[model samples]
Target: MDGKTILPRSEVPEEFTWNLSDIFASDDKWNEELEALKAYPERMAAYAGKLGESAKTLLDWFTLSDEITVRVSKFVQYASCRSDQDVGNSFYQGMRSKAFSTAVALNSAGSFEASEIMAIPDETLARFYAEEPKLETYRRSIDKLRRRKAHILSPECEKILAAAGEISESPDRTFSMFHNADMRYPDVTDAKGEVHTLTDGTFVPMLMSADRTLRENAFKAYYKRAGEFRNTYASTLDAQFKQLKFFADARHYNSTLEASLDVTEVPVEVYTNLIDAVHGNLGKMYRYVELRKKILGVDELHMYDVYTPIVADADVEISFEEAKKTALEALAVLGKDYTDVLEEAFSNRWLDVYENTGKRGGAYCTGNGWPHPYVLLNHKDNLDSMFTLVHEMGHAMHTWHSCKYQPVNTAEYVIFVAEVASTCNEILLMRHLLGKTDDRKQRAYLINHFLDQFKGTLYRQTMFAEFELQMGKMAESGEALTADALSAKYLALNKLYFGDTMISDDEIALEWTRIPHFYYNYYVFQYATSFSAAVAIANRILREGESAVKDYKKFLSGGCSKEPVELLRDMGVDMRTPAPVNDALSLFGELIDELSALLG
Candidate 1:
């Protein structure tokens, strides 16, 4: 459905809408909290330079910081959720802007807290905790701050960096505006000779169409516009990489990759190992592509042919209610407590379901400790949307479990393990569905869907991850990142990954310009790693049952209390090794074999 044809927010059923009032009953209350948060910086200022005074003083600073953090979380969460509910809403846009400003001010005001704590000798900090038992509550947080001692600069320099934070984000902000609001794509005609406006939302679905003409037209037309604005995209991306390099250099890191991975203490080898493993398994992907060409009966499989399903009538239309039931049933393996949260999410209006005008195109789970996590989904009644519901609910349940178990300071999980929970849910759901069905076509469709996930999340994201690493290196080496250079690099990688089975069109080269994730520094690789980890965990749960579920639940509850690698290690998936990636690729190959037999 087109955005213009979508229902207005008010017209959406109340049952389908998220309960934003749970955060604040009215705008008046939200504004009241906003005004109250504006005074937090002054309150935080009073204890800034006095952190070394005594144990009680330090405890008081932490106490005030926690209070302000809770309030800040609520404000930002509410504003963002409200704004995202309808992006065109001016009032919520202003509110989101003000909340961001308050957050920056709060950060600037509290910038000295870290440096001051670092200045306190370790022996002194130990003595303070000994003297005041209450200080023990923040030991983990303090330890985290102390770990960054080497990177912490002088208070003045830190303040400058804090002040420049908003300015540094201008490129990404401009790209967001350009991609979401400003940039326009041309309309393309489908096989039926019906014209549809090609959008980022509709682009993939068009590619998934069985009609080669529709897929080719959509592919060409979308990139034709992207090709026109290549220079503009390249300029914005160049500025973003330059910003990444500036921070890496300022922090004395060897590269942007190091700087990004160090934040979560992930080793550089984890990233490199993923690329290496994928490279080692390139034959499997090439074979899969060759299988697609053979099954689709295409003489020459182009890039557009990659997404179309090989199984006929595989795009099953599943209603939202059916999706909810299937998600609940599929996740019951996680045990009753986990399924209870999913039930609450459905009955208590935790989701803003369905596509509506101005609603965000994709799906995500968001909220704060103050309220239950809220989910936004542009749900279509299809198998893809069913998996999306399960995927997002996995995130919501993770947030629910973490907030319920962990302290507010450590409630939020890092992005490294964020996809683990969601992808695990997807894997388990796929398995459950596959187990229950013996229908040949149904099995083929389900297996095909699973294969697509591996292809998209594991291989495709790793390709993007490699591209991101290369771009960083190029920018650091003082090479100009022009449109032609970026496209050529991207096209080459596409050739390497897709192999000779498919024709790598020039239009596919413009794929880099349209990917929003490249703007995210070294972020796409985790999707690949997390999918691998999830596969291992899902396999364990299927094999070992309750014991595996117990371990997985503990991992979810731990949140940021431990580093991501250590957490995954505790869950029995060692990302540092190539085992998980190779196992996932092996499973991909097995699925292809199953589909091949079924198709025959």
Candidate 2:
């Protein structure tokens, strides 16, 4: 008999979407991985008493751990792919859920060993390295663990942290289940009379509908559902903040934000300067919103109006194949290694490109160093999809470069440096296409695309960072953040950023409910600062060419070998200063002027 098919969506194509075979030769191989993974928990448990045997034993334990990690990743990735294709698939969900539990166990077990290893006298651990040549790589990894040695407490303390991990994850887990599984929107019918359900996936398309009324209805219908869950959502976020605060205090950090950046060694100034940089350029953002008013002839622009295409049917809709070509042409400056690998990705099915009935929303590039990066995209035949392709490809290419240069031990990078390469690709693609376009309409569209990128990535993200700070401060100061407080804060900042041109309202306040990033503990700021650096590096590379590329590659190849700050310094950026952000915002103002004049 054929293997049991348990996907929520039973109508899945015969071939797995995006070729799971590339990662593993067949489903049979996936089963083998599962069997191996089932046997790993006990195998990992065997390391429990063995870690303290000697320094060599600790090193060998780590090696065994890495091998197990590789196997776990293989198991998890395959199961995840099946689930992503159809989240309702019970079989894969069970496997995926088990994989997560296994992962948590593995993490706890490793941390237990790491704590013992750190407690070993520093001089003794050093002498072990002298005895064993192969132990040097663990030296850096151990040094990092050593940084937390003080923060770590007794084995009893670690076990407490480990056991609480499941409960602590309730907020994120609740949000995902509710947001993805429970929420549904009313059907929004467009002027062409095309009726579409206003889903999180389809919300953007409905908002971009040429019909203003459709956008309005879509917004109203979507947020009505959000309104129903407001109290539950508020409670969920409260739990999340409490968890963050508890962890921060436990770790001896002064604040949660600091605790967060301590992971990447990124400075908080890099974050604040991003908000300041965008604030200094508000006039340009207002000007673009004013242009929306003038061109669309709307009496008032609303929050829903942001994604409304300012340009008419003039958009260049390229198929996925053509978009891949455009990305290759635009990223040619990154050198042949980039171009060649991207070509392989295109030909070899490294990307899951289409949106089927039950695939995940949005786009992401994810993989481990052992294998190349895998990018998942919900491709629309539009410019945003093209930019998204460029964006995710930026991440994959960065992963590619980093994997080539750094060892698996340090291959994964901080999110602080994550979006720079991706956003730079967006800027580069815009430059390439805009330079070639003589048509004023197309030029304005391209300029609008670039301007909108600044608005969403830079200005909007800073607004989010500001709100995030406020909420964290509120929670920190023994204040309760109700739905009222959350919405009020979000709407206030929404008005602050849009200035007088846009109408920021009650529905807009519901914005807080829509953002999943707020739950990430000070993560949205990275998008703002990454764009700041991307703007600087993009301009520098366009203006100075090879020298800028050389510096950028140094940053790319540097990995976690250094803190993000020093690494950015090696790339010719000083995170302590506000100059790069100032320059980027100034560039935004210039682009707004160009777009406005082109429209006129």
Best by lDDT: 1
TM values, all candidates: 0.96, 0.92
lDDT per residue (tens digit) for residues 1-600 in model 1: 322245877788777788889889998998998888877778888886799989999999988887887788888888888887777677877888787878888888888888999999888898998999988778888888888888888888788777777666778767766775566688899878998877776777778888889999999998998888899999999999999888888878899999888887788999999999999999999989988899899889999988888885866767889899999899998899888878988998888888766666678888365678889888867787888889888888888888888877778888889889999999999999999999999998889889989999999999999999999999899998899999999999999999998899989999998788887778889999999999999999999999999999999898788888989999899888999999999999998898999988
Query: Scored by CA lDDT, what does every candidate get?
Result: 0.86, 0.77
lDDT of 2 by residue, 410-497 (tens): 6677888888889889999999999887999988888877888988988888898999888888878988889998888888898889
- Report clash pairs, candidate 2: none
Once superposed on the true structure, which residue ranges of model 1 sit more than 4 Å away at CA? 1-5, 8-10
* Sequence-dependent TM-score of model 2: 0.92
How many pairs in model 1 have backbone atoms within 3 A of each other, for residues 3 or more apart or on separate chains, i.e. clashes?
Answer: 0
True-structure lDDT of candidate 1: 0.86
TM-score of 1: 0.96
